[model samples]
Target: MKKGSATVAQLSEFDEIIDVRSPAEFADDHIPGAVNMPVLDDAQRARVGTIYKQVSPFEARRIGGALVAENLARHLHAHFQDKPKHWRPLVYCWRGGQRSGAFVTWLRMVGWDACQLEGGYKNFRRMVIDALAQQPATLDFRIIGGATGSAKTRILEALAAAGAQVLDLEGLASHKGSVLGALPGVAQPTQKKFETALHAVLSRFSPDRPVYVEAESRKIGRVHLPTELMEAMRGSPCFAIDASREARIEFLLRDYAYLGDDVADLQRKLGCLNRIISNETLARWQDYAAVHDLPALFTELVDQHYDPLYKRSQNSNYVRFGDAIHVSTDDLSPSGIIAIADAILAKTPVRADAR
Candidate 1:
């Protein structure tokens, strides 16, 4: 790379990555680990855009330039005051345009080694998309398949804790993959952000070792999986978990105790299934929720909704589901889950071809 510019491929060569786009743009998506130091804030950017459209480009630039200078001075005193003179940073805006150019020029004049991203965040976004489309094929993945409430996520966590590579999609998405999967007081990330996170995690795994991930639908709540990754997971070998129904219900009751706190919201989430479940059954479930009879509600939900749906989706989507190695357990306690993870690790061997 040159003294004044770097490419997305050279991200790690810099001491810090700075995003000079507005906060809104940064929140939507940016290069992972990049810090936000917007030259123009959300309101200022909108104001400048309006001026450029309604008044004149020169007028907008004049006003925006002043605002950018003021913000840069604030950042210098507040954020960059303690930085060493030898610090090197990569700075970028939406495009390799005026905002980042101005910031980089200022930093360079201040005696720090600063470079602008050649194509800015647009380039990084392109890199993320391309990586997601191609990277899944490079890794060896093992799918953990089970009906809802079978502690698949817990098992994946245990696998990770046991020094195995694990990708917890639900943990990434912030929503469990179900109708009741919406977590209270938690919101899902934008689809682009989710893909960025997924790409980051996938990039870290060793191809020679198998990555354990839960079997997820194409969409987890509002965010959808990359088509290539979904295909990769669906075709991967699976470990089917067959925990007893009673055990599953008990597990769910404990895992989803938050749902019991808001009976009205729980009923509303269940009402979403009115189209598939008969009115009488829906009423019965609603009544159970109204009375805080979680055990009955969970049991009915598993028997009627979750189990049947899991059977159909797993069989149809997972190509290797028929040949899956079944792992049965009546115990989903913490120790038992670890034992299960240990057993799976013992059975799974690293692939020589992955290297």
Candidate 2:
């Protein structure tokens, strides 16, 4: 009904969230569901800042205010013209600063129920950091360990389908966790965005039941796992998925078939390991790509590279590696993956009252 402020914890009480920061600032990270309604777009914000520093703060405000007014008018005419009078929106900017303040003031002027986020995106970011630091410690984590192509991600999916709680790190990171793990054309989120998503998922689970997650390195791609989450994962008990070399190669070929679309890109990604792999071997792998023999390429990559790296990391990083319950599977077909998931759920007995 009137202009006011809501803390980060109260964000969900609103009907819509509007971010009035510049495009670049919004792209970097904002509240998870916020829609960008920048009062001053990137170029305008830059122009205003330059004037503020070199000319005068008063001049800058005058120019920025005009720009904000014009942009806000355009947004309301194009975007909010159809909104009902009762529509409630939470608006925010870099620190509940002038950009967001201006937007909220005008929205309230129109008699729509609008409010500003107190401390803005910075407040929400601090909440994510604080939650990640303490939440993982309260839950029991079960790490899913395996060599590359072991279908650990698929197995986690099946586990979730079977009603077990899972924390899908790769899913959140939009990565597959290997040298060639990047999904085609899908960019990973900013580290803050990843952390915010992680905190959101973590907050939804009950602490009494064990949370299952794939065993991953400290960094998933460009995003580094929060220190507490990484440490908790390393210290958790593990359940290893053991698949044979042939099965792994077959599974990897089927799962990563998208690589076939761009052999050159595949070769380039594989070439990242030139220092670790002998040139002759790398050349042979590239040759396999040239001939369109993907199974051969995957075989060498798994048996020689991924397997050894996984063995070393799993044994060293996860302290409970020796005690892990190993689930042996002959293949990674649909049925085979389901069987593995069933075996894992059997091994991980849950109390009836556990979440």
Root-mean-square deviation per candidate: 1.7, 2.3
For residues 1-355, what per-residue lDDT tens digits would candidate 2 score against the true structure?
A: 2338888878889999999999999998888888999999999999999999999999999999999999999999999999999899999999888999999999999998899999889888888899999998888899899888889999999999999899999999999878898999999998988898899899999988878999999988788899999888888888999888788888999999998888899899889999999999999999998878898888888879988888777889988878889999887998999999999888885632121
Off by over 4 Å in 1: 352-355
Q: Positional deviation of 33 in candidate 1, in angstroms?
A: 1.5
Cα deviation in Å at residue 343, candidate 1?
1.7
Q: lDDT values of the candidates? A: 0.91, 0.90
Supply every candidate's count of residue pairs whose N, Cα or C atoms clash at under 3 angstroms: 0, 0
Score candidate 2 by TM-score against the native: 0.96
